[model samples]
Target chain A: MIFYVVIFSILALLLVASGLYAIIQKDLLYAVISTGVISLILSVMFYLLQAPDVALTEAAIGVALTTVIFVITIRNTTRFEDENDNNKVK
Target chain B: MFGDYQNVVTMSVYGSSIALILIGLYGVLIKKHLMKIVIGLSVVDSGVNLMFVAVGYIKGGTAPIFSPSVIDSKPLMVDPVPQALVLTAIVIGFAVTAVALSLVIRLFKHHNTARIDQIKSLKW
Candidate 1:
């Protein structure tokens, strides 16, 4: 009983922390990776909450496919948020 | 308030998911980069999926799968409906993400930029 509580609290904290970091990240690639970490933690949370099917789907789709797509898109474009506009005067 | 283990666990789970959703909303509203916005959307998708599973959870209940050896214990199964619905939702979310990314690619090609503010093709 106490074990479950402790584990749940820890996972919840990690989830929120990673999410905040993902949002506030300056670099696009780092933000994408942070989002991937969020998904990975979320999958484990799903499994701990007794949804193995959802966990599997999340792992495959959220972590693997989504990250791959984002990486490809980044490759085709800029990597950083201020990469192109850093030298411009506003 | 954490004395009741089950209630506390469920509440915290739901609360964290709600926080995730709100964080994603902030990202969508405040972020200027197109890819960041898409990432926010994906985060929102994850939060909703988490909420669905959390709502459908049954304490002390096993998975809904039926086996030859466990056919007699029908009452121990958790709600299978939400799980099935989430399965479909995950697939649809993947498809939506793919389509959204493709659209972003097209937008980048047309505008020569990925920043949402710089793309002024449809702006009035």
Candidate 2:
């Protein structure tokens, strides 16, 4: 019981922290990777919560497919946030 | 100790899901980059799925699957409906993401930029 609580707390903390990092990180690649980390942690959390099916789906779609697609998109475009000219009228 | 742990488990699970949803909302609302917005949408999708699963959980319950080897005189199983619904939601979310990325690609090709503010050709 105590063990479960400890593990859950740690995973939850990591999940939230990684989520914040994913949103705030300047580099788009790092942000995408952090989102993948969140998905990975989320799958583990699903497993702990006794939802193996959801966990499996999350791992496959969220972690693998999403990251791959994002990376491909990044490769085709810019990888960092352009702070100065982001809102300039063109 | 056991009782306290149980409460913590339930509260933390639901609370974390809510926190994720709110954080995702912030990203979607505040971020300007197209890819970041898409990532935020994905995060929001995950949070909603997590909440659905967490809500369907039953304390001290096992998976809904029935296996002869694990038979018990009395069985407690988590709700299966939310799990099924979430499966569909996850797939739909994936489809939505693919389409969104394709649109992003198209936009980048047209404007040579991924920032939403700069792509104003359609703006009235």
Candidate 3:
């Protein structure tokens, strides 16, 4: 019981911290990475709760594929507005 | 922290996850950037996944597998339904992420920017 409680609380804290970082982050790439971390932690928490199936799915879909797609889009877009404007002049 | 031992902890964890979901929703509603919106969507997804996992935890539960040493012994086993549901949710989340990112990429390719304010085609 104690162990479960500790694990649950730790996972909850990680979720909150990662969510906050993702929301507050200015760089699009950074926000995407933070979101991936949130998903990865969620999968581990699922395993601890006796849900290996959910963990596997979350790891494969949320961590790997979603992060990849976001990185691809970010690579083709501007991270900051000011930098984009400077490129427009040249 | 309540009447029951495991139930109390499980409920607390689930409640916290719900709170995180709400925060993520707020981020989605308030953020103007397209990438931030995607981040909020992911945050919301994680919060929901946590709730699913918490629902499956059982106190002193053993693995669901049947062993030879316990022919007569009955052990507590955690629920498996929530885990399955969470797995489905994860797959759906990825599909949504893929589509959203693709839209973002196409939008950037045409407009040379990802900012919501810069895109005026749909706006009057």
Candidate 4:
């Protein structure tokens, strides 16, 4: 019982922190990685709560497949705009 | 103040999952990026699945199975319905994610940019 409390608290904290990181990240790729981590953490939390089916799905689809898709998209696109426009003005 | 052990765990899961859900919804509502929207969707899915699994747990229960020693006795087992539902949901989620990603790829191919504001061919 006590263990469950501790696990839940920790998982909840991690979830919040990951979500905040995902939002505040300057690099879009970093944001995607943080989001994937949030999914992974949630999957483990599901297992601890006795939801093995959900956990398995989250691990395979959310963490693995989704992350792959995001990374591919990021690779295909430019990461950031040229900030050297400011230097040219000077 | 449900005194049952299972009820306590269920309540805790609900509170935590709801918090996750709210954060996910806030992201989806505010974020402008296409990829971020997909991530938010997955987060919301996780919270809902957690709620389903928590509802299935029973106090001091074992899995539902038949054995000679307990064949005639009533068994208190966790519900399997949520597990089955979640399995179906997971597959459907995968299909949705695949379709969404394909659409994102097509959007990028048509327009040079993936930003929501930059792709404005439809806007008058």
The prediction achieving the highest DockQ against the true structure is 2
Kindly list the per-residue Cα lDDT of model 1 for residues A15-64, writing each as its tens digit. 89988988888778888898889889888888876788988999999899
Candidate 3 lDDT, B33-75, residue by residue in tens:
7777877887887888787677677756654556887657867
| Candidate 3 residue-wise lDDT, A1-90, digit = tens | 466677767777777787788888776677788888887887787677666777788888888888888888877777743445535535
lDDT by residue for model 4 (B97-118), tens: 7788677777767786656867
The reply for model 2, stretches above 4 Å from the true place, is A83-90, B70-74
Q: Tell me which residue pairs clash in candidate 1.
A: none
User: Each candidate: what lDDT?
Assistant: 0.84, 0.86, 0.75, 0.70
Candidate 3 positional error at A73, Å: 1.2
Displacement of the residue A28 alpha carbon in candidate 1, Å: 0.8
Candidate number with greatest lDDT = 2
* Tens-digit lDDT string for candidate 4 (A1-90): 667666666777787788777765646677878878977987887676556767788889878887887788767654433323324534
lDDT of 4: 0.70
Model 1 residue A61 CA deviation (Å) reads 1.3
Error of 1 at B18 (Å): 0.2
Fraction of native contacts under 8 Å reproduced by each candidate: 0.67, 0.63, 0.68, 0.33
Docking band of candidate 3: medium
